[model samples]
Target: KTAVRVSCGEEHTAVLTKGGAVFTFGSGRYGQLGHNSSQDELRPRLVAELWGAKVTEIACGRFHTLVRTDSMKVYSFGRNDQQQLGRGEDSPPSVPLPVPLQQLCATSGLVIENIFAGGDSSFATCVHKKDLCRRLKNDETPPSVENMVDTWISGCDSKLLKKIKKEIHETFSSASCMNRSFLSQSKDKHFQTSPDYPGLDFSLAQSVFKKLLKKEVLSTEVQAAVVQLLPALDGNPVGVEGLRVFLVLNELLHVIQKLKKQPNTRLAEEVAAAVQKLSPENLQIIDSKVTDVYKRDFFHHLFLRIVSDKPEMFMFNDSETLVWFSSEASEENVVNFYLFGVLCGLALYNNSIVHMSFPLVLFKKLLDVEPTLEDMIEFSEAVGGSLKYILDYEDDDLEDQDFTFKIHWDGMDVDLDPQDPQKAVTSQNKKQFIDAYVNYAFNTSVEKVFQEFQRGFFQVCDQRLLKLFHPHELQGMLVGEAVYDWEVLRQ
Candidate 1:
């Protein structure tokens, strides 16, 4: 005998003999026994109707029953509440009936893959012969098949049809009649209702359904409601909360796009103001702790826009923010990054006068150490090398200017009368200062200091920018050349 244990909230066991006989034991609250009446049979009871047909599988819902025949037909009984029995009603069946599921099966000539019965619902998967063949051809596990003959038989019964339809309407209408106050009052009620069975909160589900129905009943009215709610979406924590930030960002982008086309002056002004109020710096600080991809995308777009429009804001900030932005700016976040980059480029160019002191200070700090000199030289060389490629390109403006020159350094800390500051400070001068400073303090060769500079520049500058520096100039300084090669230097 092949025995199967079943669980319908609690445990029960059923056994099937090789000769096709079936027996069951356990909880029987409804007529789930397939033998009539609500009886809790503790011992295995032979199911008489299933005597001739070979029982292949048995499934138990909270208060319903399902049995599969060897020929792939299925039989069901007990509770039909929620149309879970696939028989279309909320009443319990007194006897086991064959279910009519032939239409579902005839659509694809497939057998049943499996059957799953939840507390108030049942689902089945059918595996078509062609699909199975394809799986087998690909060395995949082909789904075992069973025909849903039971569903078709049960559905064909006139009495069952009326019961199913009436039950559905009653369950829906009764749920609709119960308002929030009524539900709250019935919260402690012990009797199991069809819609609220298993004690799940159906308030949200009911609301969603009513909203859907309302939308169908009055399309124009619902559209006006949507328009009214559109402005409030930003404030709707329940509506927008727990949603991916990416979705919000996408919606924001769509709004921006639409504004570009239609030009909603008031909405545009409001959105722009809202964006400005929501500072990117604050958003970045908040985004760092978040691991959600959608939220990250949202914050990423916001951060990019802020930085691009106000590059000066990020110029003096820590590199962590830049790294974070770079990491999150994928194809999904590209629009944000592209807009941001454009903004940053424009900001950098437009605000040159105001930012002159800052970049100069950054450059000075970088050259202050012996290692910084090597890094700067390497960076400059990379920049020069990339310029070489551009200079070689056809129809380019760069070819009109002198492309090569040598940079010389007389000494460090030249006493300029502040009014007579030199045109520019060279890498050699910076290196000399770093060597002298380190030697006087730590007694180490400037080479070690130069190495540190290389690491620092790579850390600070974007990889694309670093690749633009000339390498020959860097190599000349490293080899102790008094005058570094500037053949490729821009005049």
Candidate 2:
């Protein structure tokens, strides 16, 4: 594979091939290309200076380039802007100069493996094989590359990371509030909240909510409560009932927001229980307003017990959930139902011991009837909101690995003959289907849907379903696209 690095100078880029060859392009004003040339190179040009040692990695900063060799040595050239080259603040080097990263590695007894350069900063990795060996020997615990990196970068202190995260949340929350107030005065009703809000309407909100709920960052009970509260909000005016509904919804929203800021299962369960108590009739009314098939399906499934005395089973014995996405059901209802399936899958995945028995059942119900790619995409987007919820509790060791979600398309041809030698293929197909469903359910984008659910819940309950409970302070938590985050982790 070829590794590429771009210089902060914005005029230069570097590429290193698996064959240990180095190439550079863009401005060579500072000889950052290490080719002893002052002229700018428009296209990739070979750097003969790095011909000896096999260069494993390359990094560049403004007017500077850094190279790491297979021997664990480091080489630097060009301007030392902010001393990013790890060289002392002196005159710029005219030619490629070797730097001693070995001292830094030796001090920590780590082997330098990688290097990265930013505009005014530089980062490097030192593999602590001995330390990992020692840890493995002392305890049965396995060593992870991520853990090693974390240790090298931040001493691997979970507590310190938590503190940093809290600081970030406070900063973001303050910024969001300021932005919300400013936008509220705008003529556009949608922009009344933050312009950057992910879920612009009820359909969007429901989609995000299911994703978060699935990750177990938000709970089913909270979902049930939101469903219960919708009808009450539909009829009530801005009176005592309205105020109570608002408060309760706001409180729930705040809890969700906080959980999104930092995921906690306990908080999710509390929210879930509150939602469970909400009236199903109210949710149906809200679903009607949204005019989406997904939302309606969600409401129907969630409140099946209250709607009809008998439980309306959606899943079959084969572990498929059949959903008919048609013009008969509004887009909103369809999207909502899709999100609900994702949520159920996420919830079960989080607490496997408790949910293992039901995943197949849930999957069977959702997949029994073939849903289109459009439906799957919408569902995937909804689940994307809750990615943080799933990632928050993931094992650090697995953080750098790719997560695969196997989706089975009904249209895709597969040989299913009983006498075929590839009987295992059928089993694989089943596994992939289950995995895709679960992955989408636990995705981060679901958090955005959860936020929308909070808004709709309060609005519907206060306006229509007020008699069941009084409104109290409510909070809305919104999480944005998190699939990107997952991809980054894999990289």
TM-score of each: 0.26, 0.27
The lDDT values for all models are: 0.41, 0.44
Best by lDDT: 2
Q: Which lDDT tens digits does candidate 2 get at residues 56-129? A: 78887777888888888888877765676677556456456667678877887788757877776678877796
- Return the lDDT, model 2, position 390: 36
Instruction: Give candidate 1's whole-model lDDT.
Output: 0.41
lDDT tens digits, residues 15-114, model 1?
A: 6554566676676665666666667788878888777898777777777777778777777776675666787454447467777775679776987756
Candidate 1: Cα lDDT at 3: 42
TM-score of the candidate numbered 2?
Answer: 0.27
lDDT at residue 310 of model 2 (Cα atoms)? 16
